[model samples]
Target: MVEDPLALWKALRNRYNHQRTVILPRARYEWTHLRIQDFKSVAEYNSALFRITSQMKLYGDTITEEDILEKTFSTFHASNVLLQQQYRAQGFTEYNQLISVILVAEQNNELLMKNHQS
Candidate 1:
């Protein structure tokens, strides 16, 4: 949906910020009761941190906007596929709601980036 690479990069960065600031903390808190040694708990934390690092690296000082956009889009697509599989297997009813939320968040991010560019 994002035709401009630079704009897409900015939008992705904003989306990452929103997730880190809003979603990750709440998820972490809700799952904190689980034992740290549990595979699920460790995997969840690692996955979240991996995503954060990947997003940060994409926008890091040395990376070009074009590279960031390409890499971010590739990663996003892969992640979405994996998420879809997981949702289908474990959270069928919640899958659509989650996807809808993600789409709206991405659209909001794009709008914010466009406003900033203007």
Candidate 2:
């Protein structure tokens, strides 16, 4: 009954892509709503962000820097509030700078945990 395997493949691909596009906004919304309190560790937080971004990247030119930044900053946890305030005081208004500060803070937290254990 496989009269046209290539055609069937194209149809399935189209359906999958359509579904992906349909949910892109919802995915971004969930990501923006994700809070630092949701994760107990830096690895968990980073992994969640990585996964969401990887999925969104599949949409090619559709994802925007503003969207990513809004999600990244809006989901700040209590631990990150200090860094957020400090960065703002230092005039670090750029999204990239904020990401860097957050990553560094995560690394520092990891090191502190390791040292405490040792």
Candidate 3:
């Protein structure tokens, strides 16, 4: 469950900030605008996907990321070749967003575990 949307927003901002620094030649335009234009960012890009997942979850779609990876890996997944190619060309922007969320959650979980262990 999402504990705090504000925290999530901040974490996402930080991730984008780091990416902007590490990947030189960052997009000249603002992310919000770019998000509108290209439908990038977690909220803008994956909101619908997440909503669908949430609905599916209510209906027993409890597939984990591992399951997703396994399925994608197994199918030789070319469901949307053009979209896949575009994502690849853009360096897996959606995947990066997902990674950012996972990293944040993992870090938070580790901290909580450490606190509990103490």
Give TM per candidate: 0.25, 0.58, 0.26
C-alpha local distance difference test of each model? 0.48, 0.68, 0.45
- Model 3 reaches what TM-score against the true structure? 0.26
Residue 40 error, candidate 3, Å = 4.6
Instruction: Report the error of model 2 at residue 11, Å.
Output: 3.8
Rank the candidate models, highest TM-score first. Answer: 2, 3, 1
- Comparison by TM-score, 1 against 3, better one: 3
RMSD of each predicted structure = 19.2, 4.0, 18.9
Report the backbone clash tally of model 1: 0
Name the better of 1 and 2 by TM-score. Answer: 2
Candidate 2 deviant stretches above 4 angstroms: 1-9, 14-18, 21-26, 57-61, 89-97, 113-118
Cα distance off (Å), candidate 3, residue 77:
13
| Weakest ten-residue segment in model 3 by summed lDDT | 28-37
| Candidate 1 stretches greater than 4 Å from native | 35-118
Superior by lDDT: candidate 2 or candidate 3: 2
Clashing pairs in 3: none
Candidate 1 least-lDDT 10 residues: 33-42
